[model samples]
Target: MPVLILGLVLFLGVHSLRIFADGWRSRQRARLGELRWKGLYALVSLVGFALICWGFGLARQHAVLLYVPPLALRHANALFTLIAFVLVAAAYVPRNHLKAAFGHPMLLGVMVWAFGHLLATGMLHDVLLFGAFLLWAVALFVASRRRDRREGTRYPAGTLRGSALTLVIGVVAWAVFARWLHLWLIGMSPMG
Candidate 1:
């Protein structure tokens, strides 16, 4: 649990710099130069991610159950996760309506993902992990939207073709992950 907490702090804290200390982040980027800054960022992110995986595995072994959700909610999580995946896809796919409207679909996706997982899983570690992500995503998304508004940022208009492609990619990816990768990597079957 301590290791999991530390990993979340490292990962989420670094990610929050742009929202909380834009000027400081800009200065660091300039001082370090783009390549070096990115390298450093990647290193920290990787280490934090590795810790998260290791700590989550360790924590789950103890199995401190909270309130077990109804089976219906677990089923609903599949739908929530599918939508989350689509929103994430919109972030990468150009000229998508989700991106144009939300201005930060990836953050929205993260929030949705965390929220769904929180509703479905009742373990202490699960709550800690997903709740942290939910809170962080909400904060970051709000901050990002405010920044965009201040800067008068406008996203590109969505094209039908691009939006369709984004939807297709998202669904396929979600299906693959939910059906196979989730079981293989996490040792749990979301569909089952």
Candidate 2:
């Protein structure tokens, strides 16, 4: 739990800099130069991510039970995860209506993913991981939207094909993860 908390603070704190301290970030970028700054940031993020995974794994071993979620909520979580994957795909695929509509598909996807997990799992580690991510996603989404509004950002109008592609890719990815990757990587299958 201590490691998890520290990792979250380090990871989320670094991520929040652009959202909360744009001026400071810019100054640092300018001082460090873009490549060097990005390199350092990526290194730190990777380390933090490793720590988070390790800590979460250790914390999960303790199995501090919270309220047991209903079986129905697990089903709902599966459905929500499918949609979340679609939104995540939209973030990468260009000119998708989902991206245009949400303006921040990645952050929105995180919200959905975290919320879905929160609904499905009831344990201290689960709550800490998902809840923290949910809060960060919400904050990032709001901050990004505000920044976009300030910049007068406009996403391109997307065609139906783009939307279809996003959906197909997301579903395929979800299927792969639900079927195999989740089990292989996380040692538990979300589908199971």
Candidate 3:
């Protein structure tokens, strides 16, 4: 639990810098130069991610139960995750409608993913991990939208073909993850 908390702090704290200290971040980026700054950022992110994975695995072994969620909620999580994958796909796919409307589909997808996992899992470690992500995503989303509005950013209008392709890719990716990757990586099958 301590290790998990530490990992979350390191990971989420670095991620929250833009949301909490935009000026400071900008100043640091300017001082460090873009290449150096990105290299440092990637290194920190990777270390934090490794710690998170290790801590999460340790926490899962203990299996501290909080509340037993109904099976229906678990099933509902599958739907939520499916939507999340689509939103994530929208972030990468060019001219997707979801990105055009949402402006930050990836952040929205993280929020949905965290929320769904929180609903389905009722362990202290699970709550800590997912809840932190949920809060961070919400904050980052709001911050990003506000920044966009301030800058008067405009997204390209999405074509039907692009949107359709994005959806198809998302669905196929979700199917593969839920069926195989989830089980292999997370040791649990979302579909089950």
Q: Rank the candidates by lDDT, best first.
A: 1, 3, 2
Lowest lDDT block of 10, candidate 2: 43-52
Best-to-worst ranking by TM-score? 1, 2, 3
Candidate-wise lDDT, in order: 0.94, 0.92, 0.92
Q: Write the per-residue lDDT of candidate 1 for residues 1-192, one digit (tens) a residue.
A: 988888998888889999888899899999999999999888888888888888899999997999999999999999999999999999999998898899999999999999999999999999999999999999999999999999999999998987998899999999999999999999999988
Q: Return the clash pairs for model 2, or none.
A: none
Clashing pairs in 3: none
* Model 2 RMSD vs true structure: 0.8
What is the lDDT for 153 in model 2? 96
- Model 3: weakest 10-residue lDDT segment is 1-10
For every candidate in turn, the CA RMSD to the true structure comes to 0.7, 0.8, 0.9
Between candidates 1 and 2, the one scoring higher on lDDT is 1
lDDT for each residue of candidate 2 in 1-192, tens digit (9 for 90 to 100): 988888898898899998889899999999999999999899888888888999999998888999899999999999989999999999988878998888889889999999999999999999999999999999999999988999999998877989899999999999999999999988898877
Which digits, one per residue and each the tens of the lDDT, describe model 3 over residues 39-76? 98888888888888889999999979999999999999
Runs in model 3 deviating more than 4 A are: none
